[model samples]
Every structure is written in structure tokens, then in C-alpha cells.
Target: MADDAQGATTPVLPPERRTAGQEHVPGNVLVSIGALLLGMLLAALDQTIVSTALPTIVSDLGGLEHLSWVVTAYMLAATAATPLWGKLGDQYGRKRLFQAAIVIFLIGSALCGLAQNMPELIGFRALQGLGGGGLMVLSMAIVGDLVPPRDRGRYQGLFGAVFGATSVLGPLLGGLFTEHLSWRWVFYINLPVGAVALVVIATVLRLPPKRTRHVIDYLGTFLIASVATCLVLVASLGGTTWDWGSPQIIGLAVLGAVLTVVFVMVERRAAEPVLPLKLFRIRTFTLSAVISFIVGFAMFGAMTFLPTFLQVVHGISPTMSGVHMLPMVIGLLLASTASGQIVSRTGRWKVFPIAGTGVTALGLLLLAHLDEHSSTTEMSGFFFVFGLGLGLVMQVLVLIVQNAVGYEDLGVATSGATFFRSIGASFGVAVFGSVFSNRLADQLTDAFRGVRLPSGVSADSLAADPRGIQSLPSSLRPDVLHAYASAITDVFLYAAPVAVVGFVLAWFLREDRLRASVTTPDVTETLASNPVERTSYDEVCRALSVLGSREGRREIYRTITERAGYDLRPATSWLLLRIKRYGSVEPAVLAERGPVPLTVIIEAARQVEERHLATRAGLDLSLTPQGEEVAERLSRAREDSLAQLLGDWWGPDRPTDLVQLVKELNGELCGSEREQPYDGGPAQRFA
Candidate 1:
């Protein structure tokens, strides 16, 4: 019957059940865990490792002139490649794609270390980012493949910790390499780490392959990358390299804006779009990714300025500035590790990110109080506090993203999240970094005028080196000091509003948990194509939940699905109520009256499926010749077990030990016996 209200075209599931691969799938899941974790390590490592080395990279390559481009190149490459990697993972199997990414990253890292100039480094870094981007997106997408979301609690937490550890470790290693070894060694470091990750992933990650048709959105990718590169270039370089009104800068900015509009139009019409606009219909997925972008923007934007502020405003050396970042890093490590373990134990994770974002915003707000007079101790407290917030949210959101979508969509869904965050971070660094520099220059000029400084001093030169201000002739030093102090303070104050934007976005964030993994791609539509009655336990649950919207109906459906997969009919009303609510019970010694317990069906199913009995479809409750014999034997055993359990609770005079007596009693009462009367008199009915 077509159910018009439910849009009755709803497909009924067939009798066959589903799984990740097939029966005894846990072994496959266990094997997959390593590959997923390896991918996670690769993804998380890319973000943090590059972040830590950027300053040293700027110094060694003499690319402060093109400093923002270094990070932008990676962001552009990763964001552009994110969707493609996802589609490929879905088509070719997750394990193979993950291993390839690790190998590719290793190759890129090796080349990155050999680069002689900024352009070469940028090109190599872009390649590395393309590979690293796959790491995060695919790791999460594979998790969707292996684990049913309902049981994904522990894995999500483990993933979160993997990401957190990478973030904290990136800076620590970056500082160590830059201080004690050649700056080029920072890029060199990924080679060894990536080799190890690759080895672990290759030996353990196994997968099943079935190819599906998919087309790459090459034009869309090109347009998106071009727009991002141009926009970021203009945002990061405007007023510094080229005046805001200059023809070259204006032309690039306008071109980027126009390309962005074209990308949207092309995506809308493409046969196989990189980012399907339809995915936004999923409320949880859409909202969570938005929040992720906001968080990434604030986190990436702030980290850039924090070190600069320490060095420029507080007169701290580069190594010392890195050291000062320790409290925040430590806070992130402890919070993320602890929260992940806790989420695994409790199977509850949504609240942590929500709360953490709120607190993080508060910490950023407090940190905004920094000025030249702000003590290092005060700064440490703020960093640690904010780091605590970061630790709570970052990795958890990715888990949430993975959980909200289906398995086939996992690659694209996860990459979509990574893409948004990448885009947001690029936007943040370009915009905020530029604003900070502009304010610093402006303050330096104003301060010099108030104190009558010599006209020859360049404000930028003074601002660039804290010592440069103090080294100035005494007649000009006081004004230089005031300008440096005020400029740095203005940057922090300006940064406050950006943190507020993140805080508000957090308020609307959705925290969805994992659901059951879809064994088949597009199960909803595929099953609907042959809409009929249910076949599997999951199908039954889905049907009842959707069709029976009245209060308590879902509970009935769920109860039946869990206890009896198919043979789910009730006996006595008492037993029926139990099965409808609390689910099946074990065979017992003393269910002497009332009805049969649910497990009778379980035993029946086991016997029938194992060929001890025959339960052919559409047989109208008639057992086959062999089934008749098996059912009789089962009835006898069930009677005995029930008698034993009910020995004290039921009638003391009832036969409690003999299987024959139970068989006779059930045969007489159930109309199975040839000699049974139509009904027992009132008192016997109770028995």
C-alpha cells in the first residue's frame, strides 16, 4: 500500500541484511583502525607542522616579501584538492587512496627540503598540501566505511587525540629544528615521520574494491583555486606591496570576486560537482561545518599574530616567543587527550566542543588586553586558557562531520569540512595579518610626531625590530617606545572583534553524534526503488520510526528489531507487552502460565536457519516435515526450561521437571493436539 503521507514511494528493505563488508566484520574493522589513524596523523600533522616552521621559513628564504604566499599556496592547493580526493576515495577504496597520499606527501616533503628559493618551496609545499589534505578527509571518510556510527564512540575520541597531539607537537618540533639546525631541516623532518606513517598504514589497511562512475570538476577546481589565490594575495599584500587603489591590485581583487560568482554557477550546473549544493539540506552537517570554518579562522588568525606580538611588542626573541607559546600548547594537549578518553568512556561528545568554543572566545577576549606593559605571566595564563578551549573543540568537530553523513559521502563530506576551514584560515591570515601591520605602521608614525622624533626614522624599520627603537638616538627613543607599545595594543584590540564573531557562530553550532553506517551506498534510494516490507533489523527500525510517528511506536519497533530479527509475533498479551517494551528474555524454568518468552523465537530462528527446522517464506505458519519434528522438540525443551525457572513462582502442583508433560500441556492448550477441546473452562484458562 502506498503511504501518501510518508511519500509512499519509500522503498521497503529486502530480506538480506547489511554490513561493512560481510559477516564477522569486526576483524576487518580492527584492521582498518590503523590506516584511519595513520591518515589522521598525516592530516593533523600538516596543519600544525607548517604553522610552527613558517617564521623560520620566512627568515631563511628571505620571503617576508612573499611570506603570506607560502601559507596561501598550501591552503589553495589543499582546498582545491579536497573534494577530488574524497570522490577518488569513494571510487577506489579508502585504504589505497590513503597510502598513496602518504607516499605523495613523502615525495613532496623530500622535494620541499631541496628547494633553493621561495617559488620552488611554495610549489613543493602546495604539492605536499594536496596530499596532506587527503589525509584528514579520507581518514574520516574511511571511518564511515568501517564502523556503524552507533558504535563509533571510541574511534571518534581516538581520532580527536591523534589530531590534538599533532597540533601540539608541530610547534615544539618547529622551534627545536629552527633553533638548533638549518631552517631547511624543518621541511626535512616530515620525510622521516611520513615514511614511518606510510609503513604502518600500508601493512595494516585492507579494503574491498568496487568502482563507481564519477567525474572530476576540473573547471570548477581551477576557478576556485584561482579566486582563492587572487583574493588571498590581494588581502595579504594590499597596502604593503601595492597600494589599495593601484590598478594591478584592484584588477586582481575584482577578478577574484568575479571568478567566485562563476564558480558557484558552474557548480550548480555541473554533472558531477565537487561540492554538491544539495548537501546543505542536511542541517547538522551544514551547521557544524560552518562552525568549524569560524573556529579555524580564529585559531589560525590569532596564532600568526601572537608570536609576532611577543617579538615585536614585548621585545622577546624568536626562540623565546616560541617558548612562551608552551602554556597554550600544553593546555591544548591535556584538554584534547583527556576529553577524547572521556568521550570514549561516556559515548557523549557534543557538549565539549560547544563549551570549549565559548570558553575559547572568552580566553581570546582576555588575551586582547595585552599591551607592552602586559607581563609574560599574564600572557601565559591567557594563552593556556584559550588553548584549553581549542583542545576541546577542534578534532571533535571532524568526528561530528563524519558521523552526520553516509559512507559514500564520507570522503566528500569530510573534505568539505577541511576545505571550509582551509578557506577560512586563509581569509583570516590574509585579512587580519594585513590589518595588524597597517595599524602598527600607523601607530608608530603618530607616536613619533607626539614626541618630536627625527624625521629620518622609518616607522616600519622601527616596528620591525624592537631593539631598533631602543637603539635610536636618545632624542627619539621615548617616542619610538610609545609608538611600538600603542601599535601592538591596537592590534590586539582589533583582534578582539574577530574572536567575538567566532563566539557567536559557536552559539548556533549543531553537535550531532554518529549513527549507524550505511552498508550500501544510497541505501535510502536503492531500497526505495523496490519499496516493500522490511528485510533487515536496520530496515525494520527505519520503517517503524518513519511510519509509526505516534508516541511509543518507535520503542516497539526498536524492541522487536533487537530481540527478533524476523519472527517477531507475540504470544500471550503479557509476553507481547514485554517484547514491545523491554525486548526478549532468556528461556526460563518457570514461565508456567501467561506466555512464551521472546527467546523462544531466537531459538526457533537459530534452529530454522541452521536447518534443524525449516521455515520457508510465505508458508502461513506451517512447519515443513523436518520443521514439525524440530519445533516439537524445541517446544518440549522450552517447556522444561520454563518449568525450572518458574518452579517457585508458579503453581507448585504444575509439572516442573518433565519435558513430556510441557509438550502435552502446550499441545492441548495451543490447538496443536488432535484431541484438544475448543476451550478450557475459566479456571484452566489462567493456567
Candidate 2:
């Protein structure tokens, strides 16, 4: 029982808690998860897949001026629509919404493939983004419906791994599709994959009906979206499309300011604000938000421009550019995984962001030195350093924000933190584009001055079509390449100071005792995918489930047995708990459900019978009176262990709803005789 993040003040019991004697495990959990993963892959892959394709897209569409909007439009729509998707899914059900999202995404993808112009493609990308946001939020939320809290962590990691794999594969796949086929294939590829996911989800997925009453913050969502649009317009179009002092630019800046003020006022009164005003009051949340924003700004801005440099300045093919970018991806993955493990072990995390920001600043400076003549070794080293810095900071921000807020605030706080980062990415790409455009124009004019151009060849033409440089007289080509190199590296030089700001901000972050539930790093969160919509209860459950998973199954039973003051083997304790929950268990059925061998289960059964803890009737085993007492003790010990993991939240003044949730989760953890907790893999077995 916990407040739904959307707006429910009262706790609504989960379906399993409300139902009397039965639990609501999905009929085919793995199949349902497979469908969900596919949905997630669609969203995650889209974020990166388009980056490598953008250069080709702009060249084919003949609008280098509108290049950034291709990425920005999708991000803007997705960020604005994310919170609404979560609320709607909670009110209705996720199954229909998830399917609807897939349909919308596929339609947009089709439209984008068929687009004949840049404006048309940008518009279609926004439409795709609308559905993409739902796919991301709902996929994670639906996992809570199908899996119990104790096993949720094991499955959640799969989602994280999907994000990680997509981050690497997306660019490579995009390059492949664009090179071997047409650039349109980048959008077209989502069709077959999405269709399969749609069919599988419609067939295999199921969930209990949910009809929760919650207030949707319509005005607040609109105001924020309007504000983001105004700012992005000013950044993308101010200098290039309109004069900085032009009415269009000034009006947009003013409108953005007015919208920000109105958004704050609307959020103060709305029942369920898109982003709660109260959270900004928390120092840790505020600082984390700022730092997350800066991280996104630097990270995405560089990612957007680096490919342009590789493709234009270095004259690399799209496929080869993606291959060249692998060092950065590897660095990010290795650093994030390592930092997460270290934090989980030491419970000390303040050092990472500080080091991360400092190294990120250094990396940006290093990238600023790239030119047409820079070696592959030099470029790879700089890219790796930048990724390492990002990996260090990105994952820890979510952890600190979640650790800082109360349970009621946890859901909003987590989403809010990522929301700022998303917003920053929009700003970063726009601003980077603006700077590159303006600087490129000046560099081209300067390079072309005092030089005779062939008929119809001009600085403007060269700026718009990078491929045009190859046809230019050889003497003119170096100037064009240098213009591009300087323009791109200047973006990085400008961004380095932003990372420094984050590094300074890291100094003020107060390190609190890390929560047991949040100790394990979720790869999806670290990658900064769309903000997942979850309630306070669901958030805690995920963290705890992940923690429980980190402590292996055999280790968990062994610890519980010791805490319960029993000297029995871990397998015996597991058997007793199983019998107590299900009334009776057949050893053969238990063995079949388990990774543990038939021999191990039979040995456990024999030990219990020898100890007078169980009596056998045919193949079914029943606990004795003494065994019943021991089982109750083990159950309490399990509950106590879970509570202890909560740290301060389990104090004497703990809320009644939280207590109920803990008990409900405990019952679910021990409920199903056929289902066992995920213990890493099938190779793991109880001793």
C-alpha cells in the first residue's frame, strides 16, 4: 500500500493483496516479458539509431538547416508525453495502451520512410515520439504486474541489458540500413520488428483490470511543453533562421519565460503536478536535477556533432563511422558497470560524479583538438575518455535522488530527475546545432573569400551539401574541411565549461547512507532512457527485489535461517517455507520447478523427515506441528530481514501502508510452489 505517483493520496491494494486466496501470476511470464522487451527495444533503439542516419537524411532531404529538429522533435514530444502515458496506463490497463503505442510508432515510422522532405520527416518523428514515450514507461510498469517483487529485480535487469545492447547496436544497425539500403530504411526497419511485438503482445500478454481514479495535470503538461518548444526554437533558429534581435527570436524568449512562470504556478495548485514543486525544495533533488541536466547537455550535444565530424571532416562512410564510435560505447558500458559494483560494495558514491565531471571536462577539451588530420588513435582515445566520464556520473544521479526523497516523493523525484536530463538533451542538441550553423557559415565565407568559385558554387552551397566538397577544386576542398572541423570542435570547446559547472556542483552533494534496495545499478537507468513511470510502492519493490537478487537464493535462505535462530541447512529451510505456503509439496514437483536437482530436493525432503519436521503421505510432504512453528519463525525472520534492508524507513513510526506492502511482498515471495526466485540462472542450485 503506497500512494500512486500520479495523484492517489490513499493507498490502493495491489491485485494479489485484494484477491483472497490466489496470486495473479501471469500464465506465461517469459513470453510476456519477451513481448515487453521488444516494445522496449523499439523505444531504446530509436533514440540512437537515428543519430548515424541524420547526416544522410539531411543530405538526401536537402535541408542541412533543419538537421537538429530531426532529433529534437522526437525528444520534445516524448518528454512531454511520458508522464501522461504512465497515468493513463495506471487508470486503464497497460496491455491495450502498449499495443496502441506500437501501432502509433509503426505508423510514424512508415510516414517517416515515405517522407519526401525534412519538414515532413520532422513532423513524422514527433508522431513517432508520442508513441515511443508510452512504450518506454509502460514496458517497465507492466513488469510489476507480471512478476513478484522478489523476482522483479532479476527481470528488470533484462530491460537494462536491452538498453545497453541497443545503445551499441542502434548506431551500427542504422549505419547498416542507411548504407546497404536507403537512409529511409532506418525508419522502415522498425516495421517488421514492431509488428512481431504487436502480434506477440496481443496474444500472450495479460493483466488484471485496474481503474484507479487520478487527476491528470493537463495544463501543466501543456505549459511545460510550450516552454520547451519556445526555448528550443530560440536555440535552433535564433541566429541562423532569424536575427538574434529579430521579433521572432525576442518573442520566443519572452514567451518561454512567461510559460515557465505559469508552469510553476499551475503545478503549485494541480492535484498531481507533472513535476511537483515540493521536490525542488529538497537540496539534494535540486542539485541532482541541475547536474543531470548538465550531463545530458554535454553528452547528447557531443554525440550529435561527433558523427558530422567523422562523416564530413574525415570523409568516412556511415558504416565505418559507427564502427569508429565503438570505443566510446565500450567505455560507457565498462565504466557504468564497474562504478555500480563499487558503489554497491563500498556504499560510498560521492567520489564518482566529481571524478566523472572532471574527466568529462578534460575529455571535452581533448575533443576540441580534433581536426581533419587527427589520427584514428587520437580520436578514439578522446571519445573513450568522454564516455568514461559520462558513465561515471549518469548512473549515480538517479540513486542519490531516490535516496534523498521520502517514499511519497520517490516516484516523482526519480522521473523529475530524468525529465530535466531529457530537457537538457533537447537544449544541448539545439544549441549545438545553432552554434555549428552560425560558425560554419562564417568559416565558409572566410575560407571562400579572395578565391574564385566556379559557376553556381558558393559558400552557402558548400555549407548545405557536404558531399559538394568532393566535387570542388582540390584547393577549395581543404578550406571546406577545415571549416567543418573548426565548427564542430568549437561546439565541444563551448561544452567543456558546462561539464566544469557540474563538477563544481558535485562538491555540494551530501553523501547519505546508501539504501540496500538501490545498491545494485540498473543499466537502463544509467543509460538515461525515457523516465519510467512508477508509483512509490513499485519503486521500493524494484530496489528491494534487485537487492534480494543480489543476495543469491541459497544465500538468502541461509541468512534467513540463521536470523530465525535455526541450525538447519539452507535447502531444509527452503523446503519448510515452501510447505508452509502451499500446505503440501511433492518433492518431484518441487524439483521440476527448480534449478536444484531431483537428488538435492529428495535429500532435503529426507533431512526434514529424519528431523521429524515433515510427514509424508504418498508423494506429498506435510509439515509437522514443530515444523509449522519453525516455518512461522522463518517467515518473521524473512520479513525482518526485508525491513532491515529499508534502513530508516522501517523505524517505529513506519506507515501502516508500508507495513502492509512489506507483508504482501513477503507473502508473494513465498507463495507459489511452482515458481522459484530467479537465482542468476539455471546453473545456480541450492545446497
Candidate 3:
């Protein structure tokens, strides 16, 4: 995080941590970038790896009937536990939890690979998912800890590919195992990969414990987890063994609904609620969460059927099916990485999510029309477009939500977002599964109307079973194939409408310009409004949303100065963002990973002081009454500019466009330079 703009020295954290601006380290930035990237990879991999294996797993274990449960179990376990992990990580530390997740996932992976049956496999997959949940969340939370949102795009880009890539790789590996080896190898693969990630994280990642003392909200956790589990189960079971109208299904739905209401009530009274209810107050966070659920709905609805269509209808081997999955992976990687760079350079994020979702909706339209006879190229094209949309929205939403809330609430915001997406995915699977199964069963009954059926074939067995497609006789197989293909197409047709809903949600995302100079003090002031919450290296080179600016650290400093009264309390995180962003303007990102050294910031400050441009007394970060007074003055000045600049842009919600405009202006060569000097007049002494 670069505290200095284009080599111009400044403590960027606002409110309290405004630096009298002393402290510096000449080197120690490159290492931090590496760590962030690693953390990101872990999350994306977990998400993608299981997609291709479902078919092989279902067929091999004689559990095609319970295939949905495999995916559902993972989604439920991971999402239900997300808030708990994020809150604990914030309370204790990020790196600690990040490492812990890797270990947990490793164990679960081994168990999944070793399972003797589908029932056993599902249990292990749930364990793996519990650990996997922490990977995505902790990485995002840690990025908030060290990098500011404005310049996070570049680093986000580097790590963003993993999200799309994992989606592709997961299928490919699953296919490989299903075709050439056992499908269980898909889970086993995590062992070696997790080991490599663990090594990088252990050596390179670092985070100090927060000084605050707070208790974990046990009751709130139980309520949230119970509600989440119930919703997930209802979604997973609705169309399969249980009817939407069945008492079992309805009761699950009702119980989950009631539990969710109870969770809201309990949180209001808890001292340290797992969910930061206050984050919903922010327009960005609210909109982002809504849209995230839509994205998940659209994505899962389509993905849930692709493998089965390939195996059951097209007769493609699982491994070849994985090969066919590459188009989407390529598309996701291209869009996500490109979008990340675009956002970083421009500091505009709103448009990406909107456009991404819109694109996804269009892709779904194409898939909805697909049949088994469609050419491979045509199918791949649909997947590619779908993948691109997913890529654009995935990381961007996390960054947007994190930026919308206070530092302490970073974990809560991320966890909340993740939980919703997980829930949405489960919901999509359930709703569409019911629709597909009903359609397929009807089609099957009609196709076989005049033909004599085999001895054990029964409608009750077919409707109650997830594996009915695999049981048709060769004479009736063609009919079943046609039904399966039509059912899948129908599922995507419904998914298209779900995506359209997300597009509507995206339409409302509010775009805000990032402040070029954020003092640490500013984030602390956020604590004044939000008393609620808020690590990692891995595979420490890919996942932390790395920003190339120290501005957030400056804001954090400002917040501290405003709340607790201090300017530029010693920290190494500020250097990470600043150096990562402008350091390229200065030099390449360092290869090592960790927080930038505090002395580096001090020395950089010393360099400024020696140059004789800025003075110390007014500029230095300290806890005296005068510092607080200065903070009030600075806050008002910044707010005044917000009014002046934002006043002219009145019309539709141009969130993405607005952010881009601000990012460009803050950089050295562009837009807002002429007016920038207006706000900092005597504020130059601090520089």
C-alpha cells in the first residue's frame, strides 16, 4: 500500500492515523504481493475442482440419485461456517486462520479420496468445504487489512485468474480421474497442492493480533449456522427425494425461515454478533450482496447440468468432458484479469459487475437453447461467455463490499456476501433440479408409453431417485437421452430468468470515487459508526486483493487519529499497498511476500523531511488534542470536495463509470490533478 502518491509523500489513512508521516522502509513490498496472490489461489481452486468430478463420482458410487448432495454438502458446510471463520479470524488473526484452513482442507481431501461409498464421500466433502470456506473469505478480509480498494484491482487481477482457472481445472481433473483413474483422485489432488500452499504461507505471511478484546457470539453462530444448514438442505432436497409440497420439505423451509428471523433478533442483542448487521446500512454492501446471490443463482443453475448432459446424453467420457470445459475457464481468466487491471488503473468498479452479470444472462440464453446435437464449438462458446461473466463479477464483488464497510467489518461483510452466494447456489440447484426432474419424468413416461418396461422400472423409483437416467434399457435409451437433454435445456431456460433478476440488482449499485489519500485514522472513525468486525499467503502469491497504493493505510491512520487520537502509528501494511501500486512506477513488485517494514515508511517520511518541503509538528502523527483538531479540519475539507465533485454527476447510478473516473484522476498523468491542490493547501506541510 503506497502512502506516497507518485513519490509525493503523505500518510494516507484518514481520521486518526494521519502520519506526522514519519517511518519508512526502503524494501519489503514485493514479498507482500506474493503472499496475497497465494491466498487467492486457494479459494478459487476449492470452488472449481469439484465441478467435473460429480458425474464420475455419482456413476461410480451407484449414487447418481444423490449426486446433488455432494455439491450441496460442500456449499452448506462452507457457507454455514463462513461468518464464524471470518469473525474469529478478525478477532485473532488472518494468517493464523488461513493456514488453519489449508490444513483442514488437506485432511478433508484425504478423507474424500479414501471414502468407500457415496455416503462416506459426502461427509468428507463437507469437511473439506468447511475448511474451503475460510480460504476465500480470509483472503478477502486480509486484503482489506493490508490493501485499500481503490488500487486493489491490479493485484486482484493477478489473483483473479485463479477463480476462472479453478473452474476449468476442477472439471479437467475430475474428468481425468473419472476417465483414466478413479474419480476420488480429484479430492486427492488437493493434498499436494495444499502442501505447496502451506509452505508458501507459513514462511511468507505475517499478521499481528489486534489489541482489542471481544467474545465470540456463540448463540448467534448457532442460529446462523442452523438457518443456513436448513435452507441448504431444503434447496438440495426439494426436487429430488422430497417434493416442494411435502411436509418434510415444507418444514425444512419453514424452520429455516424462522431460524433466519431468529438470527436477526439474536444478533441485535449480542455483544459481538457474527454478522455485522450495520454493514447493510452501506448502499454498496447492500447492492453487492443482492447481486452476488443472483450471480450464484445464474452460475450454479447452468453448471449443475453440464456434466450430466455430457456423460448421460452426449456419451462423452468424464475426462473429455473436462477438456470441453476449458473454453469457459479461458473466458473467465481473460475477463477477470483484464477487468481487474482496468479497475486498478481507473479505480472504477461498479460497471464490471453490472456488465458481467448482463453478459452472463446472455450466455444463459444461448445455453438454454442447447441440445445434445449442438456442435462442440457451439457448446464451448456458451461456456466461455458464461465463464467470462462469472469472472468479472466474482472478485469485484468481494472488493466492492469490503471497501463499502469499515476495516473492522471487513470480515463480516465478506462472510455475509459469501454466505448469500453459497445459499443462492444451493437454491438454484434445488429449484432447477425440481423443474428438470419433473420435465424429464414426464417426457420419459410419454416416450415409453407403448413399450413394455423392464421388470424393476417404476415411476416411484424414478421420481424418488436421482439416478433414473442411468437405468433405462438400450431400446429406450435414446428416448431417455432426449429427455435428459431437454430437461437440462429447460433448467438453463429458468436460469436465464434468474440471471435477469441479478441484472436488475446490478443496475442499482452505487459507484463512489476513492479518496486518493486515506489516513489510517479514517478507518478508525468508521469504527465510530460501526462497532462490529473484521489474512494470508499461499499458493502466498495469488489471492490477497493487492492494491498499488498506500492510501488505505493512510485512511486507517486518519481513523485512528480521529477516534483514539494518533497520527501514523507505526505499521507495515501501509507500505504494502503504496509500494505495490506506485512501486511499479518506481520499480517492479518485489518477489518476496509479507507486510512492508514500518521503518520503510519512516525512512520515506525522513526523505521528505530532509528535502525541506514539509514540516514535522503539524504533519507528524501523534495523540495530542491538536491532532484530533487537525483531523476534524481535514475530514471537513475532504467532505467539501465530495460535495463539489459529486454534485455535477446527477442522473442514473453510474457506479462503475464514476469509480474509473476517480482512479484515473488520482494517478500522476491524468484528470483531477489541476483541482487536487485546492483541498490540501496548507495540508502540504504534512506531505
Candidate with maximal lDDT: 2
Q: Scored by Cα lDDT, where does model 3 land?
A: 0.59
lDDT of 1 by residue, 135-164 (tens): 756775565445432223335446656755
- Pairs of residues clashing in candidate 2: none
Sorted by lDDT (best first), the order is 2, 3, 1
lDDT of candidate 3 over 1-687, digit per residue (tens): 333223322124322331121112112434655654554555455555566777666656665555666776777677666666766786677778888988888899899889888889889888987787777567655654454333344444444455545556667777777678777777777777678778866775554444334677878878877886786677667766787799999999899889989999988888877776887889888887788777776667566668878777788887888788778767766776677557656778888888888889888888887886889989999989998888777657765765565434554675567556766776776566667767777776777788887788765454444356567777777776777788778888878877778778887887776432211111111101011123111111121112223233455434433543334432322322232222111101121122234455565445433433223444332222443344344334333332233333312553453444334323321111111211123332212
Q: After superposing candidate 1 on the true structure, give the runs of residues whose Cα lies further than 4 Å from its correct spot.
A: 1-42, 92-96, 115-117, 139-157, 197-206, 279-290, 311-323, 329-361, 388-418, 443-489, 502-687
Candidate 2: how many backbone clashes? 0
Query: Considering lDDT, which of the candidate structures 2 and 3 is the better prediction for this target?
Result: 2
Cα lDDT of model 2 by residue, 623-650, tens digit: 9999999999998988888888888778
Q: All candidates' TM-scores?
A: 0.63, 0.91, 0.67
RMSD of 1: 15.3
- Candidate structures ordered by TM-score, highest first: 2, 3, 1
TM-score of 1: 0.63
Of the candidates shown, which would achieve the greatest TM-score relative to the real structure?
2
